[model samples]
Target: MKTLIFKTASGYLLPLLVLFSVFILLRGHYLPGGGFVGGLIASIAFVIHSFANGLEETKHLIKMHPGFLMPVGLLLAILAGASPLFIGETFMTGLWFENPVPVIGMVGSALFFDLGVYLVVIGVTLTIIFTISETL
Candidate 1:
């Protein structure tokens, strides 16, 4: 497959899409968006990149195999949800801590879950785009 490099339009649009995805992900906890929606949006960005560039270029952009990351993300998410169980609490219970320092206090399993979702979304998004593009 021929490798296509990023052009000016893609360069500008990619960052915008990624920023939007992050915004959605962050606001998801309270608003209509969430990790899933954010992931989808981010995946769309990659898809756009794949369309603008070629499959080989996209492959080159990925430093590691996306499949490997998926399990890690899943584990993090599971561990997050299961953390409360270890402490004799119910599943998916919220845990909060007071910080001696700034507003950054040790948060509960929810943040971990979000992190897991973030990684999973990124991994899956990359994998889907790479796979489909390669087949073309």
Candidate 2:
């Protein structure tokens, strides 16, 4: 069928797109492409996959319902924000530590916060998209 051909042809593209989304997510703290953009990019990829295959297959590919992404991402963000409180500093303090590994160099609570945001975006986007797609 037409769907089978389309899915097979485009199946290889999903991984590449997801990887690029991750790259954007990681570099976002320093530059323009943060969670919002990265999450959007990832959602787009999933959307493509969903269209090519179907809602159920896309869900199976991720092995999780879209609803799960929001809470976990929220938890990560909250924990990152609360980290400073545990260290006797102000809430959501930007605490930076020099990593022994270069490239990554300095790590901070801000990075974790950013990561949490990234997850939230992905979760919420997927939740909405999948819900809509499933309904139709």
Please, what is the whole-model Cα lDDT of each candidate in the order they appear? 0.73, 0.81
TM-score list, all predictions: 0.79, 0.87
lDDT of 1 by residue, 1-136 (tens): 2233445566677789988988777666556876777777877776776677765665567667877778898999899888889889998897655553243235556667876797798888788767776776
Please give the distance, in angstroms, between residue 106's alpha carbon in candidate 2 and its true position after superposition. 3.0
Candidate 2 per-residue lDDT over residues 14-128, each given as its tens digit: 8888888888877777788877788888888888888888888888899987678888888988999998898799988887776634665456776788788888888888889
Clash pairs, model 1 backbone: 28-33
Instruction: Name the lDDT of candidate 2.
Output: 0.81
- Largest TM-score belongs to which candidate? 2
- The candidate scoring highest on lDDT is 2
Error of 2 at 25 (Å): 1.0
* Model 1 residue 128 lDDT score: 73
- Per-model root-mean-square deviation over C-alphas: 3.6, 2.1
